[model samples]
Structures are given as C-alpha cells and as structure tokens.
Target: MTTPPHHPARRNLLRVAAAGAVSAAGLAAATPAWGRTTAAPASPPPGLSDPVQRGDLVVDVRDHGAVGDGVADDTAAIQAALDEGRGRTVYIPPGTYPVSTMLTVFGGTTVLATATTVIRRTDGPSIVGNGVLGDMTATGFDGESDIVIQGGVWDVNASNVALNGNGFSFSHGRNIRVYDVRVRDVQGWHAMELNAVETVRVVNCRFEGFSDPQGNRQYSEAVHMDYAGGPGHFTLFGAPDFYGCKDVEVSGCYAGPSADFPSYPRLVGSHGGPDGHQHTGLRVVSNYADQCTEWAVRLYDWLDGVVQGNQIVGGGGGIQIGPAGVQTGGNVVVSGNTLRGLAGVQEAAGRPPDAAICVGRLNNARTHRLTVADNVVEGVAMEGISVYRTDGCVVSGNVVEDCEGAGIRLHDAPRAVVTSNAVARTGGESIVVADASNAALVAQNRADDATAAGVRVTGTVAEVVVRGNVVRGDAAYGIAIGAGATGTWHTGNDLRGGYTTGPVDDQGSGSLTDPAGVA
Candidate 1:
C-alpha cells in the first residue's frame, strides 16, 4: 500500500471522504490497516427473530438456558452463547439483559444489537476482548484480528470504585473496530480502554456520564488508551496509558463526563511511551467534547497526529500539546476546530488558567514543526494561543479574541511564522515575540483594541521581521521594539489614530524604514 510521495495528500483526501459514509462498507474501505486486515460485514445480518445461523455456528443466549429478565444473572448463558458464536455473529435481542460478570468476545465474532438493546454491568469488569495470542515471551507483538464490537448501549449504574470495570476493553489487537455504540454511566476508570493496539477505528460512538464516587475526579476518563509495552505488544487497561500504539483513529463521537457536574474529565490522554517507542499516527476528528475539567484532548510523547474539525467547549484547555518534562514527537497538526470558554471551566489542582490552544514545554523537553491554524478561540482567561519553547512552528489564520491576557504569545520559539491571524480586545499585548526569539516572521496580522501594545518584540530578540501588519485602537505603543533588542526590522505597517503611547517606538538598534506610513 505504498503510494508516491506526492500522493499522500490525495490519499488523505480520499480517506476523509470515505470515512463519512454511514455504511459499514464505507468504514472498512476508508480505514487503513496498521498490521492486520479488516473485512466489514458484506451485508446486514438476517433479522433478530431466530438464532443467528452463519455457517455451522449458532448462538442464542435464550436457547442456552438464559433469561433476559432484568433480575436474573445471565452471565453464564451469555458467555456460553459467545463461545458458540466463535467465527460467527452473536445476536442480542432488544431487552434489558443483566450481566453479572464480564463477557469476553472471542476472536472473529460480531455482537449486533437492536434499538432497544441494553447490557447492564451488575458486577465485575464489564467486557474484555483479548487479542493477544501465544505465550508472549518476547518484548513486543501479539495476536488477534478483525474483532468487531458494534451497536449496543452498555450502562454501568455510576458505581464509584475503580477495580476492573470498563465499558469496553480491547487490547493487543490489529484492525479492531467499534462502531455506533453508546456507553453511559460508567462508574469505573473509563468508558472505553484501548492499550497497545494498532489500527483501531472507533466511529459514531457516544460515551457519557463518567464519575468517581469518592469525589476524586482525577481518575475518571471518557476514553483511555495507554499502557503500550513495546511495538505490537498486547497490553490492556481500563484507563488510558498510550505507550506504543500506532495508526489509531477516534472519530465522529460525543464524549463527556457529567452534563450537570463541573468535574475533571480527562477526555483523552496518552501517558508513558517507554524505550523511545512513541505512540504515532493518531487521527481525532469531528468529535464533540464538553464540560471537561482537564483538556478535552491531550498528548504526551506523541508524534505525527492530527486533531481537526472538532467542537470543544468548557474544558481546562481545549487542546494541549506537550507540557512540562514531556518531549513531543514532531509534525503534529491542529486545525479547523472551534474552541470556546475554557477559562471558566473547573480547574484541576496545581493547574493555572488554561489556554484554548497551546504548545509548550515546562521542563527541558521541546516541540518542533507544529501547526496551529484556522481555529477560533474566544473568551478565555489567559492567552488564546501560546507557543513556548517550541521551534519551527506555524501559527496562522486563527481568530483569537476577548481574552483576559495576550491573544498570541511566542516565547523562546525560534524560526517560527505568525501570519494572517486576527487578535482583538485582549487584556494584554495582542501579539508578542519575546525571550530571545530569533529569525521569526510576524507578517500580515491584524490587532485591534488591545489593552497593551499591538505587537511587542522584547527580551533581546534578534533578526525578527515585522511586516505588513495593521494595528488600531491599542492602548499602548502600536509596535514596540523594547530596549536591548537588536536586529529587528519593522516595515510597511498601518498604525494610525489609536495608540495612547504613540506608534512605532523603536528603542532598539534595528531599522524602522516606514515611520510616516506606519506610524
């Protein structure tokens, strides 16, 4: 499946087009395999009247001495039904089935449900799909393929302990697909837990109402994917610990904690990627995340991912890249998202006022070649978008407005581009490049009604270019090149009738060639 170097963009376009189809055929076709094959159901299974008879396999939980009454424990009968459903389709009729224990889906089986179907987790962990094969003596790599879990409403009654319960847990598998499922009231760690998996496609799912009964929101997550051992290792957990997964996609889903409670819901996160085995090739698109106390989307030590076309609201931060001692892998793209009102969301302990979109390093770790474009970040408490200690990044075509602090700030970022952005009514500087930033381009941006300077270059910056920008209604200097800054070039800006401290104040030894036209 190798295409030409010029063909990647075209291929991505086709894949995105194919991913939006509502049919299983379209999903199977659009999805690319990391290490295994995926064969979608060619046609919908026969009606839900009789036992599902596919070839020699037949599974009817009712025929296995099971009752779907909401009182009885049907775990043994349903487990027997699943055992009979190996290599076939296991069908559950539309009723309230009380499962007292975990039900495992063997390899090559499908669970299809009707509109009124419900699986209630009464005890033990919810559901486990073990895709690992063999003794697993080595460091990485395991088994199982083509495991599909789709179309059911799995519910846990907000039980308040983190023992082993997860709505669905799948690990050590390739080409695993979960489609059109809804999970609610999960009382454990996460709604869905995926670890050490490759080529996972979770589409059109709804996960809601994650809670901690002990009043500790730190452990609750909607979808957790971590605990990757080595490449292809078959590891699993109920909470996310992204260690070594690759080629993962979580698309077209609605995920949140409680709609009523202001709590910390780790919407999605990846923790430790050990031994330099970075979790890579992730795609998170077209999802809705709401009321998160932590970030709606976050990554640590991750590389080569795309977070696009999402509607994220009321989170600690809308999307957070590497933070504090985590060195991120390169070429991450964040675009086409609508993120609003993160400053008023519930904050976790030791967390500061959050940004709508941010890429930074708190310790010695660094981020490179990141792209933040075409996003709308408004009504935030701090900077709308901040790039700190990152190199070779691009901040373009974004609308950042009505923030309590600077609209866009670049600190210690070298060789970066900040272009074609709109910043308005910020409490601090609209755009700032400071702390030894060099060789940066600040071009074609517009700033208005800023409480501080429109564009401020300070802290010993060098070789910076400020060109073709428009600044109006700023409270302080329109373009301020502070003292001790050198090698600055200010040219062709439009700054008239708005600055209280006057325009184009050059305190440095750089050239300002457009004094009359700009100031």
Candidate 2:
C-alpha cells in the first residue's frame, strides 16, 4: 500500500495558526494593519522548536544515533530517552523510525512528534521494532503515570502490540493518554492493548489494515482491554483479573477490516476468562467500527458501563453482551446507537434464525440487570433483539425494520421487561416470549406487517403482562398465548389482525373502551 506523505512545514504552519488566534481586544490593541487580528512572530519548524520553547529535556530520537527509512535498529536510542525518567519529552523528528522490537515509555515521559514522525516495523514475527509489544513485559513504564505519546504515526507490521500484556502486568500509575496518533496494519490481536492499567484514555486515533485471510488466528481489534491472560491448560483470564483496570475510556477512534469475511471482526472485550469477573466501569463511546468480521463490541463480563452513540456497520453481530458460561451483570446499559446490515442469517440459514443483539448466559449462574434501549436497528436478517438465559433485563424503546425473524425474542429468561419498541416488516412474530417464567412484561409496543402473530408467548411463561400494545397487518393471529402460560393479563391492547381463539376476554376483567371497539 502507498503511504501518505508527511509535510513538516505545513504542520508547523497549522500549529502557528492554532496558537495565533487572540482575543479581539488584544488583536485590536496589538496590530490593526490589513484588518488582521494579531501580529505573530515566525515559528520554527515543528520538531525544531528552540530549547527554551520546547518541552523539558528534548532528546531527538534520530539525533541520539537512531536511523529511519524502514530499516536500521533504533530501539536503544529511543530507550535512552525513556531511561531519563520523569518530566522529559522525547522528540522524534520527521522521519520513519523502523522498529523490530517493542519500545516502553517510562513514567513522566512525553513522546511528542510531528505528523511526519513515523514509528513503524518491517514484516517479521508478531514481535517487531520500537513500538510496545510482547518483548517489553514491564509494568508502569508503557504510557503510564502522566506519560503521553501524542501527535505521530505508529505503523505496526506485526500484531498484538500491548503496553501491558496480562494480569501479572499492573500499572498503578494514572493519567496516561495516547492521542492524535495513527496505528495501522496489526496482523493479530489488538492494535493497542492495555491490560490492568488505570485512567487510560485513547482519543482521536485511527487503526487500519488489520486483516487475517487464513482465519487461523484472530485478526485485529483497534483498542483492547482485559485482565492479564492466566496460566495453565485453560488459556483465558477470569473477570476478577481486570477489576484493577477501571475508568477506561476509548472515544473517537476507528478500527476495521478485521477478518477474511468483511462482516466479522475480532472480538473486543474486557472479560477474557471463565471466571466472569473481569472488566468493570468501562466506556466505549462515540467510536466507529466498519467491515468487522465478528462483533463490533463485545462486553464479556462487568458492571456499570455505557456503550452509547456508536456507529457499527457490517459485522457478524453489532454487540454480543454476555457469552455463555460467564456472569456479567449489574447496571449495564447499551443505548442510543446505530447498527445496520448485521449478518445473522448466514449462521442459521438452514435452521431457525437468531437475533441481532444476542444476550447470552449470565455470569457465574447469576442473573444480571441489563438495559438495552433506545437504539435503531435496520436491515438485520434475524431477530432485532434476542435474550437467552438472562433475568431482570429491560429491552425497550428500540426501532427495528426489515428483519427475517422475530423483532424481539425472550428465551429462558425471567422477569424481563420488553416495552415501547416499534417493529415493522418482519417475516416472523414481532415479539416472541419463550420459556420465560416468573412474571415478564411486554407492554406498549407496536408490531406492523408481520407474517405471524404480533406477540407469541410460549413455554411456561407465567404472570406475563401484555398491555397497551398495537398489532396490525399480521398474517396470522395478533396475539398467541400458549397452553402452559398462566396468569397473563392482556389489557387495553389494539389488535387489528384477528385472534385465533376469537376475541378473548381481557385478563384484567375489563372491557375494551376504545372507539374502534377492539382492544
């Protein structure tokens, strides 16, 4: 692939323009010539700022006996600046610094570079030059404790470049930021991996060229978080392992082209192991995931996190909440997002179809309190939302269109509240409640142009409250309550399509009072 050119002079001019803006009073008082704002002095080139104007201890990586041009090993020269300790800035001049090994940043070190400064690697093992990877497995030194690596291009030739590898790796240090950078071409795992680190923020970054054709190994994820991978025959780490890494925020980033199939990307998650206590208090917001072969965002296990305001398109599933055999629960909310063109029918083309949002088992045999609400789903081949083996969850206020299976599905869950959703043009039932016992509520939703019933409740559903809903243009019955269902109260609902059991009495012992004469 052809690389983009880096212009230092243009960057310098932009920086001057940014710093040149002044208050109206100051501009008028200082300079009135030519109607321009303020008179500013000419600034030096980006990396060539005077020592007095530069940050503390500016050690140029190229001047410290390092070489660029996609060759020559500059690991030692770069490591020297990291060894200088806190409150120092390492300046990388405008050139491509090829790395064959990982480079670790120590506490109080700031790596500030121009856009022309590129840290890259050649094709080799997953481990390659200068950027942080498996070779440097130390803690509290890779962008931790007020360390910042900003304003540069980081091109990864290999995959799995991690700042801290696993749970054994811990950085108590805080306030780390990797901002305004570009990371490209990671072959395995994540482009940027942070394990058990505190207060880490990645903003305004781009990760590209992460693909695996053979599918032998997992391909690329832009940003990854988890507890350290644990030991023994079982490879994955448990949920408690990542509890140390809290308050992690990843915003305004992009990751794509993860696997051979354009629809699936590698899984992104905080929980890695069977223990089901890994990640907690995390936020993955305002990001974009395109051409992913798998899930766009996967939350394995945790509590109190928001996956909001994201654009996820062309993935196997937009979001997979809790995988089977994991207990991820408590105050988790997935809201206000746009997920389109999810490929769910390909997995079940011959068998029964599935849903778009697949909520798997609760963690450690425990129920969770989940809220999946206020999202727009379009062009999904399966159900719009699917719940499996979860309890005390609310799936409400979502709009789904052009789905092949049920719009909202409840399977083997108890006490779930499905309300205020609008589903249209579905090939199957608009809402299906299956095997849910102990009182579930399906209320105030609209199902239109469904081939089957608007609501189908089956398999031991008890004490269900189907109230204040509208069903129209269904080919079959408007509502079908199965034989085993008990104590169901169908109250004040509009059923435009005829019912199979004739006009059953409202379970609340109330009469239909609407002017249309049906409820």
Candidate 3:
C-alpha cells in the first residue's frame, strides 16, 4: 500500500481523468489503479488521499470507490467519502446506492444529490447528523455550521428494521436546511426528526406512505421535531415531532400517508423535558396533508406560532391546539386554510370524536388569545370549530358546512367574539354559546339548514349578545333558549322559514327584541 504524493488542487482533475479509464475497465482493474483490493476493508482503501477539490472541494463518491450498484452494500465506501467531505460538498451522482447502516453527516458539509440519485436504506436511519458515536460526540455545532441536505430520494424499508427508525435524523444543530428531498414508504417512526434544534427550516419536501403494515402497534408520522430525551437522542419518536424547538418553520411541503394506514404527518410538542421547555416560535404554512389519523396539523403546548394556508384532507380532524389535563398553549393564529373530509372515526367508541378545529382545554380554561379566522371546513365529524374554556379568542369570517355536530360552539369561553361567519347544514345546532360562557358577542352571522336549531343559547351563560343574524330552515326550533340560559340578550335577528315545531322556542327568561313574538 503506497500513498499518493501531495499534489495541489489542479492535479486532482488529472487524477480524476486518469481514473476514468481504470473505472471503465472493471472493478478488477480498480484494485491496483487506486491501490485497493477488498470490498469491505478494515480501514479506508489504501493510498487514498484527502478529497480532491475543483473549486469548493467537491467530493464525488465515485472517485472514492463507491459502486452505487444497489445490490452491494455501499455503506463503507460512502462513509469513507463522507469522512473526506467533512468541510466540503459531497456530490452523489445519478444512481441507486444501498445502505445497511447509518451515514453520519458532520456540520458544514452539504450532501447534494441529483434528482435521479436514490439512497435506499435497508436498515436503520439513512442519514444522521448528530447522535451518539463511540465515546466522542459530534453536536453539529462543534466548530461547524450550515449543514444542508438537499435533493435526493430516500426509500425506507420498515420490515427490515427496528420500530424506532427515520430517514433523516438531525438533532442539536443550528441553521439546518432540509430542502427539496423526497422520502418514500417510511413505515416505522418518522421520515425526519429534529430534536432540540434551533433556527431550522424545512422547505419544499415531499413525504409519502407512512404506516405499519404489520399492525397499528406503533405510531408513525412524516416529520417530527422536539426535545425528547437528550439533544442527541430520542424519548419517543414522532414524525416531525416538535417538543422543545425554537424558531422553526415548515413550508411548502406535502405529508401523505398510505391509504390503509392511520398516521399523522405533522406532530409538534409531543415530547418534553422535565423542566418543560414549551416548543415555541414555530410556523407551519403552505403545506398539504392527506389521510392523517388525527389532526392534519396537531399542536400541543406550543406558543407564538402560525398555521396558515394549508390544505388538509381525509383525516380524523383538521387542526388541534392545546393538550390534555392542565397544559395550555396560546398566542397562535390559524387562518386561511381549507379543511375538508376530516373525522376519520365514525363509529369507534373510545376517544372523543374529532372536530375540524379545536382550541383550548377540554374541561377548563387554559389557553388564550387564539385567533381562528377565514378558514373553510366541510364534512366535519363533530363541531366545525370549538373554543373550549379559552379566553380572549376570536372566531371570525369562517365557513362551516355539512358537519355532524354544531357548526361552531363556544364552551365556557369568556370574552370571545363569533362574527361574520356562515354556517349551514349542521347535524345539531348551527351556533351555540353554552357552558357558562360569558361576555360573548355572536353577531353578524348567518345560520341555515340545521337539524336542531339555528342558534341555541344554553347552559348558565351571562352577558351574552346575539344580534343582527339570520336564522332559517330548521326542522325543530329556529332559536331555542334552554331553560338554563340566563342573562342573555337576543335581538335584531331575522327569523324566517319557521321551524317545524315553532318559529322561536324561548324557554329561558332572557330579554328578546324580535318580531317573532315568542315569550
């Protein structure tokens, strides 16, 4: 084994040209030409020098003895290439490379690939940026910066690996960019997981076919980012799970699950530390989600974020905010999205049925200052939008149609405004202010074609004003005030196409200034 002479960058091009003939001859001739004989050597190929550079030191894996034949395990050859590409660009040409082990990517290294290049992972994660490695550690920030992974196709085989798996595992990095990549057929855990990361942006990526064909014993998603175990490890694996990340954004991506599998693509705030770092400063915008098990966009204990302009379809629910028990997440905006065909659970009796959008706590007031506006929800299983036990929230200019439950309901939410919206074809009441909700203004809205009533003010509510609305076409009562409703002011509403039972059935003693002549 002889080492090459120390040559300058210009000599690198000549070496590449000289190696072309030897590479074309055969893998047999490659032994002496580059001074390598074995397929899986104990160390790197003998006489291999530092990666050659043209301008920015482009380390082509082919020059480093990678066959990329899809049958042979190219893990060792690719690993050696990555070692040479520590501070440079690692270029993968158009070929399918089979990997049986993980590829560690150090910081300041760009793993760029052509669209025709495919990295097929038979076992374990395809690429890992920061994690446990021997007794040493690489935090992706240990004197490094700007780790970019762009433009490749990753195929993950769930049947061949453990339950906790991923295509790209990037943790404890800053300014990480994963863009324009395609991940296909991820079966076990997640496609991408970002743990304890800051200032990361994921843009214009595509993920498809996330499921467990064996059974639903394990949950899987497309992308997960969070603070789970350590910054370099996992407590629980979720697709794009965001537990304690800050200043993250996911934009212009697609999360599509298999038709047979029930899984979510975007999961935020799934894991946390005992100190409770609240997963803040996130944005999910301009994405498309299909066939999710639960909410298309699920947020738990997240703060200071915006979920806008996303098209979510064929899921258990559309968007969900807040967590169970006493956990609260607030100061979020959900606007300008199309949520349709949600609520995957129709008859399964255990968990409460899902809604198009749900905010705040289920049993108490925990979240605040949430604005849900200008969204469209159709064919929702339960309520289109429910503000439960939250304060200072605004639900305005939204449209709900063909829902199984109430179009919009404010359950014990105080100081809320439901204005300028349209509700139609609801299975229950079109709009409801119930459960001790106080200081509510349900004004300038239109409700029609309800199985129950157009607007129902029930429960022990106070300081309620329902004014300047249109209620029409109900089989039962148009506006039914339950006997428990009190301190209600209902006025300036046009009640037309009187109910089958009666136009207005006001059982409560609330003040009413309407022309319907109901006592």
lDDT of each: 0.70, 0.62, 0.70
Per-candidate alpha-carbon RMSD to the true structure: 8.3, 8.5, 8.8
The runs of at least 3 residues in candidate 2 whose Cα sits more than 4 Å from the true structure, single-residue gaps closed, are: 1-57, 123-144, 158-173, 218-220, 231-244, 258-267, 274-276, 323-328, 345-354, 361-367, 498-519
For 125-218, candidate 1 gives per-residue lDDT tens digits of 6554543223243223244555666677887656533454678866666667777788877764677877767887778888877666666556
**Candidate 3 residue spans exceeding 4 A from truth:** 1-55, 132-145, 159-163, 217-219, 230-243, 257-269, 272-276, 324-326, 346-351, 361-365, 509-519
Q: Regarding lDDT, does 2 or 3 come out ahead?
A: 3
Worst 10 residues of 2 by lDDT: 232-241
Please report the candidate that would top lDDT against the real structure. Answer: 1
Name the TM-score of candidate 1: 0.82
The TM-score of predicted model 3 comes to: 0.81
TM per candidate comes to 0.82, 0.77, 0.81
lDDT of model 2 at position 425: 84
